[model samples]
Structures are given as C-alpha cells and as structure tokens.
Target: MSLPVLLLVILALAAIAYVTGRGRAFRTASGDIRQLHSLPAYYGWNAALSVLLPALVVLLLWISIQPVVINNSVSALISEESVAESSLDLVLSDVRRVADGLDMAVETGALSAADARSLTSTGTDVRALLGSVGVALGSDVSEETLDAAQRYRGMSSYGAILRSVLVLAVGIGGFVIGFRASHKDFRARNTVERVVLGILIAAASIAILTTLGIALSLIFNTVEFFKVYPAADFFFGLTWSPSFGGGSELGIVPLIWATLYISLIALAVAVPVGLFAAIYLSEYAGSAVRAVAKPLLEVLAGIPTIVYGLFALLTVGPLLVDIFGQGGLLGLGWMKGGTAVMTAGLVMGIMLIPFVSSLSDDIINAVPQAMRDGSLGLGATHSETVKQVILPAALPGIVGAILLAASRAIGETMIVVLGAGAAARLSLNPFEAMTTVTAKIVSQLTGDADFASPEALVAFALGMTLFIITLGLNVFALYIVRKYREQYD
Candidate 1:
C-alpha cells in the first residue's frame, strides 16, 4: 500500500478499536458508567491513541531507515570511474532520480514492467525514455548508473512491502493490548492525560531544539568561512566585494553601515508619528473616532512587505526622483535615480508605523486611570497629566514598541532590494544607492558559485551578523523596560 493509504487504513483500524474499547468498558461497568474508574470517552480515546501512536512511530522509523539501507546497498554497484568523474553524492542522486523516474513510468503505463526490466543503456536511450515520463536528465546515462538505478528500484520495492507489514503488525498488537487494558478498575483518564502531557512536552522540546539547531548550523558554517577568509577582513575591512575566484574582499563594514543608516531613517519616521497617534487615540480621541482611526492605521500592517516594496519601486521611488533628482521640481540635482537609500528608508519607515502605533496605543491605555485622575485632582491640565504622569509610567513599554519596530526595519529585505540599489558601499549621501546585510546574504548564496567556496559560505557569516544585531536589540529593549519598571512601581 502507498504511505497515505496505509495511514488511512491505520486510522480506520483505530476507529474500530475505539468502538470495541468503549463497548468493552460499558460491558465491564455492567452498563453503569458510575461504576467505571474513568469516563467512557476516556476509555475509547485511550485505545485509539494506543493504535495510532505506536503505528506512527514505527512508520516514521521505517521510512527514515529504508532509504539509507537501500542507498548503501546500491552504492556498491556504482563504479570508481563514475565516482572519479563526479562526486559520489552526485552520482548517487542521479541513480535515485533514475529509479524514481522508472517507477513513475511504470505506474503511469508509459513503460510496462516487462519492458522496463529488459531495458539497458546500450539498447535503449534511457534518458529519452525517462524524459518521456517527465523526468529530465542533465547528462547521458552511464552503464554503471543504470545498473545502480535498477538495484535501487528493486531494493526500495521490497523495503516498502516489508515496512507495510511491520507497521500493520505493530498497530494490531497495540489494539489488542489497549482493548485488554480497558477494565472497570483501570485508570483510563490518568493514562490518557499522561500521554497528552508527554506529547505536549515533546512538541515544546522540538521547537527549542529546532532553534538551537539553526544557531549551531550558522556557527559551524561561519567558523568555516572565517578559517578560509580572515576574521579581521570579514569584520573590520572597508569593502564588500565577493568573487567566485580567489582574492575576494569579504568585508562586512559597509553592509553594517548601510543597515544602520537605513534603520535610523526608518526609526526617525516611525517613532514620532506613531507615538503621537497612539497618544491621541488612547488619551484624547472620542470612542467612535478611535474605533475608526485605529483600525485604519493598523490596516497598513496587514499589507504584505512585498506589496510595500512594489509601492516603493513603482510609485514612491519615482516620486522621490521627481522631487530630488537633477532638473526636476526643486532643480537641486541631489538624487540621480529612483533607487537610493532614502527611498528604501522612507518606505520601510512607512511599513513600520503601524507596528509602533498599535503597540504604543495598547501600552498607553494600560496605564492606570487612577494615575491620570490623581494628577487632575491636583489641578493639573489634561495635557500636563499625560506628560508628567501617564507618559512616565508608560515610557518603558513605549521604548519596547519602538525597538521592536526598529528590529523589523533592520531585518527588512524586499523594500531594500526594490527601493535601494544593490551596490554595497559606505557613503554619507542618503540619495546614493547602497545595500544591507540581508540583501547581500541572498545575493551571495545564489548563482553558480560552489557551496564550499568562501564566496558562498560568507552568506552564513552575514546571517549570523544579522542574528546578533537583532538579538542584541531584544536584550537591550528588555533591559530598559525592566530597569525603569522597578523604579516606576
């Protein structure tokens, strides 16, 4: 059976187990649920989980192990000549691809089983045959490769059959054990709760481990990059040119400079406007106006960044060029073209405004009404109370909101790619084209460069740099909030 069909069959078995277990519990209780140790539903669920969980575990283990075993067995058929011509991994991939393609051809009736078994690279154009079934090959099929592919297909077919049998056997055994365990005295609810808790803990551990795995991957690759290219050059050097050939300048200084410059301009636009809107909505605006205005302001947040980037590229960038470019509205000639640092920064700042305003509005509203009333009772004006009492109390949260917006601005990619040009340089002019670390990371990993080369590996170093900068922002924002929170309370 196919994998999905096998899972559906297992689920059907579990459903039968559920009914059998529930009936067994009902019979054991003498048709009185009050006499049972747990609820009737718990007994059914306990049995169903038993049939589902063990079968899934076995199915997963079998699926993961089957390919490795088959690959190893077929690897022996690959000749040393093929390995010398191309890497072993690449040759093995071609073998697997050919095997899969043949399987597809047979299943789709493009090639019959008898014809597929008798086919050879000498007598048949194997690439053309596979291509007829929608599998494209990059090169001509070799004799050893075709043989290895045949072996691979045979082993995989047998392995899949064995897997189905073992998984079904395990599922049946689980059903029997769980059905027998369902008795009037059995603690079915406790058992079900323990299983659920175990699942939740496993899920939590998987998330944390996934994050740790990402950190470790970046660290290992960044270490490899630094070992090849000098760490000093990668960190403090002035340029950011990476060539596929040797003797590339892999400095990060210019990228970091542009990143900070764009982020600063974004924050300058987002912070004041967002904070003021938040103040008005929270403190001064009528309820109807606040309802209409807040959601309208927040609507900007729902628009995807790519859409915003398109606006930057098609609309905002051109507008800026008309205003600031040579022989235009002002005749200043400061801007040369549509793509520039100012264009990206302005668009990014516009995107960040909703993030800042929504967070600040919520934080400002969270300040106690008693605080505002107390200042007013002391003959203070409404504006004076907001400035002296409410603002101080909510300053920490506002700072957090601003820093969160800053983090998003710093990490933005599409707006930078579409609005600012891709020239990685350190310059004082905001109108000049520049690039950020995130954009460079994308450029470096793409194209025909070898994966092991420093040029490609530098993307990891760039990613790690962005990770550190964002992490530092979070830590600093947290510190500021905690420090001032204690003082205010």
Candidate 2:
C-alpha cells in the first residue's frame, strides 16, 4: 500500500481500538463508569495511543531506512565504467527519477506492466516515452542507468508491501494488548498522562536537536571555508569580490556594513511609526476605531515580503528616483537609478511595521492597568501617565519587540535582493546600490561555482556570521528584558 493509505489504515485501527477499549471498560465496570479507576475517555485515549503511536514509529523507521537500503543496492549495480565521467550521486538521482516516472506511467495506463519490466534504452526511446507521460529527463538514459532504475523500482515495490504488512501487524498487536489491559482497576489516566508527558518531552528535544543540527552543519562547512580562505580576509578585510578563478578577494566588511546600514535605516523608519501606531490603538483609540484600524494596519503584515520587494522594485524605487535622481526635483545627481540602499531599506521598514505594532501592542497591554490607574489617581493626564508610568513599566517588552523587528530586518532577503542592487560597495550614500551579506550569500552559491572553491564555501561562513549576529541580538534582548522588567506586588 502507499504511505497515505497505510496511514489511513493506522488511523482507522486507532479509532476502532478507542471504541473497543471504551466498550470493554464499560463491561468490566458492569456499565457503571463510577466503579472504574479512570474515565471512559482516558481508557479510549490509552488504547488509541497504543494502537497509533507504535505503528507510526514503525512506519517512520521504515520510510527512513528504505531509501538508504534501496539506494545502496541499486548503486552497487552501477558499474564503475558507467559513472567514470559523471558523479555517482547525480547518476543515482537520475535513476530514481526515471524509476518514479516509469511507475507513474504504469499507474496511469500509459505503459503496461510488461513494457515497464522489459523496457530497454536502445529498443525503446526511454526519454521520449517518459516525456510523453509528462516526465522530462535532462538527458537520454544509458543502459546501466535504465537497469539500475528497474532494479530500484522492483525493490521499492517489494519494500512498500512489506512495510504496509508490518505496520498493520504492529497496530493490531498493540490494540489487542491495550484492550486486554483495560480493566476496572487499571490506572488508565496515569498511563495516558505519562504518554502525554513523554510526547511533550520529545517535542522539546526535537526542537533543540534541530537547532543543534543546523549549528553543527554551519560550523563544519564554515571550518572548511576557513581552510581555503584566510580568516582575517573574511572577517577584517575591506573589499568584497568573489571569483571562482584563483586570487579573488573575499572580504566581508562591505557586506556587513551594508547590512547594518540598511537595517539601521529600516529600524529608523519602522520603530517610531509602529510604536506610535501601537500606542494609539492600545491606549488612545476608541474601541470602534481600534477594531477597524488595527486590522487594516496589520493587513500589511499578511502581504508577503516578495510582494513588498516588487513594490520596492516598481513603485517606491521609481518614486524615489523621481525625487532624488539626477536632474530631478532635488537635482542633486546623487541617485543614479531605481535600485539603491534607500529603496530596500524603506520597503523593508514598511514590511516590518506590522510586526512591531502587533508585538508592541500586546506588550503594552500586558502592563498592569493598576499602574495607569494610580497615575490617573494622582491627577496625571492620560498622556502624561502613558509617557511616565505605563511606558516605563512596558519598556523591557517594547525593547524586546524592537529587537525582534531588528532581527527580522537583518534577516530579510527578498526585499534586499529585489530593491538593493547587487553591488558590494562600502559607500556611505544610501542612494548608491550596495548588497548585504544575505544577497551575497545567494549570489555566491547560485551558479556553477564548485563547492570546493572558496566562492561557494564562503556562503557557509556568511551564514554562520549571520546566525551569530541574530543569536547575539536575541541574547541581548533576553538580558535586557530580564534586567529591566518591573515586578508588581
């Protein structure tokens, strides 16, 4: 069976187990639920967990292991002479794609089962056949690749059948065991609670493990990057140029400068506007106005960042060019084109306003109402109270919110890629086009650059640096939040 069908069967088994366990519990208690150790729902949950969890675990392991086993088996069949010109991994990928295409063709009745089994590259035009069935190959399939794909498909089909059987058996066995264990005296509630606790712990551990995995991956590749490029050149040098050819400069200073400069401009634009909007909505606005205006303001957040990038590219960039471009209204001749640091920064700042407003509004509302009441009781005006008592009380959270926005601005890629032209210069003029580290990272790894070259590997180092900067910002935000948060009696 397919994975989705197998999953549906497992869920059906769990549902059946739930009902059976509940009925068995009722019978054990002589139809008096009061006589049971736990509630009927708890008993049902216990059986459901028993039936579904183990089967799902087995299914996961099977899915994980099947690919490795099948790949290794099929790869062994690929002769060394066949892959002497091309990489083995790329060849294996093509084999898998062709195999999947053949399976799809068989399923759709475009090719008979017999034809799929006895197909040959020379006798049948494999590429043209696959393309006819809506599977396009980059190149014609060789005889060795065709044979490997056929073996792979056969082994995969067998594995799927075996996997379905084993998973169903495990589910059935768990149901039987759980149903038998459901008695009037059994601690069904405690067992279910323990399972829930284990699940929560697993979720937390998975999050930590995922972060660790990302960090380790970046660290390993960054170390490899440093092995090829000098650390001082990457960190302290002033220029930013990367070429696949030897003797290219790989300085990161210009990229870092552009990142901070753009982010600074973004914060300057976002902080005042977003914070003021939050203050108006949370404190001063009538309920009706808040209801209408708040959602409309936050509509900006729901718009995708790529949309903002396009706005920067089309609308904002041209408007700014009209104002600041050479021989324009300002007549300064400073701005040359539509793509510049100012264009990206302004658009990015617009994108971040909703984030700051939404978060800061919540943080401001979280300040105790008693603080505002006391200020008012002391004859302070509403504006005065907000400026003095409420603002200080919520300052820590507001700082954290701003820092979060700053992190977002720093990490923005789409807007930078579209609005800020990809010229890595350290010029102070915001009108001039310059790129950030993120834009450079995308550009560096985009083309046919070899991973072994510093041009490609530097992407990892840039990623690591960006990761560190964001991490440091988060840490500092936490420290400020803890240190300055006012406690109430």
Candidate 3:
C-alpha cells in the first residue's frame, strides 16, 4: 500500500461519510419534531469537517516530524570516529543525500547486484544492533528498529504498508465520528460558521506571516549591505556607476530622480484623463454609454504589463522619437532618443488610466444621491453640482487612489525596462534617457557573478525601499477608505 493509494482510500471513505451524514441529517430534520435546529446542508457540512480535521492534523504533524526523527536516529547510529572527523552539518547533508539516493534507486529499479547484496547484509546487522539500542532507550524496539533497518535494505514494503494503514484508519475514524454527530439536535449552523471564521483567520495569519518574513529577510540583508558600503555613500552620493570593473561606484540619487521624474510624467497623463472620464461617467453619461464604455476601459487594465512593455518599446518609443525628432518639433535633436523617461512615463500613464478612472468613478457614485438632488433643486447646473458636491465629497478617496497609482508607477518594471534608457543619469529633461531603481535592481541581480557580491546585496536594499513605499501607500489608502466609510455610514 503506497501513500497515494492510502490517500485515495481515505478520500473515498470521507466522501461516503459526507453523503451518508447529509442523508441522515435531512431525514432527522424532517421528522415530526416541529423544526430542525439548523439546515440539513449545514449538518452535512459540519459532519464532513469533523471527519477531515483530526485526520488532516495528524497527517500534517506526521509529515513535518518524521524526517527529523529519522535523521536523528540515523545520526546516532553513525560511528563515533566518523562523527568526530566531520562537521555535523556536512555529515547530515551527506546522510540525507545518501538516503535520498537509496530511495530513488529502489523506486527506479536501478540498484546493482553488488549494492543489493551489501544492503541486505548491512540491513540485517543494523536491525539486530538497533533492537538492543532501542530496548536500552526504553521504547518500542522491534517495530521502530525494523522500520529504520529497512532503509538500508533499499526496501520499504512493510513500512509503506503500515503507513498506509495508519493514514486510512485515521481518515475512516474521522468520517465515522462526523457522520454519527450529524442529527436534528446538532448545532450544525453554528459549527459551519465557526469553520468559516477559522478559515478566514488562518488566511489572514498566513498573510501577516508572509509580510513579516519578507520584512525580516530584507532588513537583515540591508544591514549587511550598509556594513560593507557606508551609509553616507549609499544615501547621499550622486554618482551611480557600479560595475564589474575595479573603480565601480554605487549611488542612489540618480536612480531616485529618474523614478520621480517618470512617475510625475505618468501622473500628468493619467490624472486629468481619468478624472474627467470619471466625472463625465458619473455625472453626465447615460447608462447606455456607461454600459458600453466601462468594461471596455477595464479591458485596458486586463492587458498584461509585459504586453504594455512591448507596446512601449515597439509603438510608443518610436512614435515619440518621430514626433520630437531632430527634423521635427522645433528642431529638438537632443530629444530624439527612442527610450527616454517620457516614453516610459507615457506608457505607464496609459496602463494606469483604468486604475484611476474605476476607483474614482466608484467613489464618485458612492456620494449620496440626495446631495446631487439637493444641488439640482437649488437650481445648480450639472457641472456645478459635480464640481461642488460630488468631487469635493470624493476628494480624499481620489487622492488616495492617486497615491496608490503613484506607488504602482514607481514600482512598475516592464515599461521602464523597455522604454526608459538603461543609463543612470540625473538630468532635468524628460526627453533624455534615464534609469530607475527597479531597472537598476534588475540589472544588478541578473549579472553573471557571485550572489555574495556587494552589487547583488544592493538589490535587497532597493527591494526594501520599494516594499516600504508601497506598504505605506496601501496603509494610507485603507485609512482613507475607513474614514470615508465612517463619515457616510
């Protein structure tokens, strides 16, 4: 009996239990007791959960602890001479690798005749010795020693059977218990509600844990980076020309400038267009127009950022160069570069239009209709009503949305990678080629060198900065939404 077979058997038993429980619950609820405490479906769900939870918990604990327990036993069996000669970590790595190799060879039918003979002889000796050791240790000697000894034989037939039996027994037990508990008197609804709440809490816990893990990893690495490169050079220095060459320098000011410039340009393009579109849609556009246009605009958002990157590279960059080329647009030859801050920014703005408009429209529509009616009743024009009442009411939300969009623009990688030039420079002209922190991080991390290099460490520092900025923006957005909700509700 393999693990997969055991799992399939368990699943089949659980499914059967669920069906039986549902039927029993339904019959009991329909009896002449006036009414059931909860719905028949809820009772069924409660029974199914009871069947599953304990078995799953056992399985999880078994899987997590089994390796450590096995490894510790194997370590104790190794010769003291061998243990004294090598580091614990190295020996453990080797032992694990050997165990893994044996397992793979057995699974693939690749064990040689010599190896098979050696394994058989060693397994017998190990089993005989391990039993005495286990007895001395005051545990179940025969069973545990036999299972461990089987590892050296390149055979796990008995152990596999036992594992399968245990798993199946647990699953079957859970199913039977859950099925028996499903009755008219059971508080099935409350049980189901508790399960749902538990699931939500688990999901939230995982999210927080993941965030903390990332923050810790970044902080540790950034501390190491600052130790190697002084804080002053990293923070205040203007030059950023780090490379594999001997005289490499690394500074963040130029990258920061490029990021700010590109984001500013993106806001310049997205804000006015998105705001006007939201205003028109909410205050003036007919339902028919809204129905056709809303989803179509959202379709733009659905387009992948990589696709936008290609669009920026092939379509937008060339168009910008052509329009502001040397022979055109007041003979501004200096603005002829195909990849520039403006090109990336413009493309990013296009990408964010849906983000801005959709958020703005929802906030605008959330304003009380009575406010609009009152403004109209006072003989205010539609434009005036929107300008004075709706827009003002939704201002905080709109500002929050814009800040979020700014963060997004700052974090954007694809458009900048394709459209913004790779040269890190601090120039006022948006037409000139420039690079951003994200672009530099990508460049540094992708280089063919040791991962322990100072250049590589810089990426973690940059990532930390980016993470903090985005996290701040999100926190601010949540605050705005909460405040607005309180005001209206």
Candidate 4:
C-alpha cells in the first residue's frame, strides 16, 4: 500500500479507538462524567495518541530503513567490475528507476505481472518494452543489472507488505491496551499531557540537533579543505583564483572585502531612510495614514529578492551606467556596464528598507508613551521629544534591527549574483564589479570539480566563514541590546 493510504488507515483506526475508549470510560463511570477523574475527551485523546504514535513511529522507521537496505542489497549484486568507473550510487539509482517503471507498467496493464517477474522470456527486449510503456532507460540494461532490479522489486514489495501488517497490528494492539486502561481511576489527562510535552520536547530537540549537525558537517569539510590547501593562504592571501588544476591561488580575502564593502554601502543607504520612515509612521502619522502607508511600505518586503535583482539588472543598473558611463551626462566613465557594486548595493539597500522600517516601527512604538509625554510637557518640541526620548529608548532595538539587516545583506546571494558581477575583486570604486563569499561558494561547488579536490572543498570553508561572521554579528547585536536596553516596569 502507498504511504498516504497506510497513514489514512492508521488515522481511521485511531478515530475508532478514540470513540470506543471514550464510550468505555463513560460506562466505567456509569454514564456520569463526574464519576471519572478526567473528562471523556481526555480519555479519547489518550487512546487516539496510543494508537497513532506507535504506528507513526513504526512507519517512519520502516520508510527510512527500507531504502538503505534495498540499496545495499541491490548494490551488492552489481559487481564492481560490471560498474567499471561509474559511481555505484548512479548505477543503483538507475536500477531503482527501472524497477519503479516496471512496477508502473504492471500496474497500468501495459506489462503483465508474469512477464515482469520473468525477464528471460523469449524475444522480449525488456528495455525497449519498458521504453514503449514510457520508462526511458539511459542504456540497454545488462543481464546482471536486470536481475538485480528484479530482486530489488521483489524485496521492496515484500517489505511494503510486511510494513503494512506490522503497523496495523501495532495500532490495533495499542488501541486494545489503551481502551482496557480507560477507567474511572485512570489519569488520562496526565498521561495525554505527558505525551504532548514529549512531542514538544522532540520538536525543540530536532531544531537544535539540526543546527549542530550542520556545524559539524561544515567543520569536518573545512578541516579537510585546510588539510589540502594551507590555512594561511585560504584566509590571508589576497587573491581568489581556483582552478581544478594544481597550483591555483585559493585566497578568500577578495571575496570577504567585497562582501563587507557591499554590505556597508547597503547599510548606509538603508539605515537613515528606514529609520526616518519608521519615525514618520510611528510618531507623527495619523491613524488612517499609518494604516494605509505602513502596509504599502511593507509591500516591498513581500517582493522576492530575485525580483529586486531583476530591477537592479534591467532598470537601476542601466540607468546608473547611462548617467555615469562614457558619453553620458557628466561623462565620468566610471561605470562601463550594468553590473557593478553600486547597482547591487542600492537594490539590496532598497530590499532591506522594509525589514528595518517594520522592526524599528515596532521598537519605536514599544517605547513608553509617558516618556514622550514628559519630554514634550517640559516644553520640548515634537522633534526634540522624539530625538531625545523615543529614539534613545528604542536605540538598542534599532541597532539590533540594523545589524540584522546587515547580516541579511551580507548573506544575500541572488541579488549579488544578478546585480553585482561575479568577478571576485577588491576595489575602492563603487562602480566596479564585485562578488561576495556566497557567490564564490556557489561558483566553486558547481561544474566538474572533484568533491575531494581543494577547489570544491573551498566552498565549505567559505560557507563556514560566512556562518561565523553572521553568528558574530548576531551575538554582538544581542550583547548591545542586553547591555543598554532600558527596563519598563
């Protein structure tokens, strides 16, 4: 049976268990709910959870293990000599795909089940037959591969059958146990609450474990990268030119410099405009104006960064080049093309404006009105009151908002890729093309570079560096917020 169908069956069984358990609980309490220690719904939940959780666990475990088992068993059948230099993974993937296609053909009545089971049937080109039935194999299947695929199909079918039986049996048994345990003296509410708490803890642990896993993976790969390429050159060397061939310079300084320069320009354009916009909306605008204007401004946030990159590439970059390029007004000859640092920085700044304004508006509004009132009552003008009282009160949060936006700008890939040119260069002129660490990471991992090679592994080091920089920015922002933020009792 399909996974979704099995899940639906499990849910149906759980529903039945819930109804039966609730009914049994009422009978045990002699149809008087007050006689029971907990509500009928609690008893129902206890039974429902008992049936669902174990069955779901079994299903998940089976789904995860079945693929690994099948892959190992089928891969063992394909001899290393037969595979030549091709990846075992790729061969196994082809085997699985062909097997799945054969199964589909059998299901759709294009190929009989008996014919699918026996590949040695007279005059039958299995690959051609499969292709006629819409299963396109990359090449003619060898005899050994065809045999392995057949074994894979048989094992998968048996495994599915066994899995369905085990899941259903566990669900029924759990329902029986839970229903029998449902009585007047049973603490159904406490049991159900504990189950819920366990689920919540599991969810929280998944997030933490996922982050730790990512960090460990990055660290392992970075260590490997340094083993092949000197750490000093990777971190401190000024050039970044990676060739799959040996003796290539693998410095990250140029990428880091461009990343920081673009981020600084973005912050310079974003901070003042977003902060001022927040001040206008929060402290000065009327209710109707605030409602209309705030949402309209925040609409920029919903637009994807790719769209902004297009805006930069198609509209802003060309306009700037026309204004600043040779034979233009002022004729500076500074910008030669549409892709440059200024183009990306300006669009990124525009993209970050909504983030800053939204967060800063909330922070500004969070400042106590009494502080504003007291400052104004002391004969301070509205501007002075906002500048002296409200802004000061919200300064830490505003700083946090700016740093968060900065981190985003630093990590952004699509805008930098499409707006700023991909050449990793360190230059003082904003009109010159540049690239960031994220873009380099993408470029390094792509193409025909071997995974074990320094060229490919450098991507991990670049990723780890970007991760650390963003992490440090976040930590600093939190420290500033905690150290200077005022408490309102």
Scored by lDDT, the top model is 2
Candidate 1 residues 39-129, lDDT tens each?
A: 9988998999999999999999998988888888988988888888877888988988898899999999988888777679999889988
For residues 1-489, write the lDDT of model 2, one tens digit per residue.
989999999999999999999889999999998999999988988999999999999999999999999999999988887678677887898898899899989989988999999999999989988887788776679988899999999999999999999999999999998899888899999999999999999999998999899999999999999998899989998988777888889899999999999999999999999999999999999999999999999999899988999999999898998999988898888789899999999999998899889988988887888888989999999999989988888888889888988888889899999999999998989999999999988998899778889999999999999999998898888776666554642
Higher-scoring candidate on lDDT, 2 or 3: 2
Residues 1-489 of candidate 4: C-alpha lDDT, one tens digit per residue: 878899999999999989999999999999998999999999999999999999999999999999999888898899887678577876887788789888988988988888888875245777777787687766678777788889999999999999999999999999999899899889999999999999999999999999899999999999999999999998999998888888889889999999999999899999999999999999899999999999999999999988999999999899999999987677999999989999999999999999899989988888888898899899999999988889988998899989989989999998899999988877899999999999998999889778999999999999999999998998888776666455753
Off by over 4 Å in 3: 1-11, 25-36, 58-166, 244-247, 328-330
Tell me the spans in candidate 2 whose CA falls farther than 4 Å from its real position: 482-486
lDDT of 2 at 379: 100
Query: Candidate 2's C-alpha lDDT?
Result: 0.91
Worst 10 residues of 4 by lDDT: 480-489
lDDT of each: 0.90, 0.91, 0.77, 0.90
Ranking by TM-score: 2, 4, 1, 3
Error of 2 at 480 (Å): 2.4
Worst 10-residue lDDT window for candidate 1 reads 480-489
Which candidate's TM-score is highest?
A: 2
**Error of model 3, residue 309, in angstroms:** 0.6
Tell me how many clashing residue pairs each candidate has.
0, 0, 0, 0
| TM-score of candidate 3 to 2 decimals | 0.78
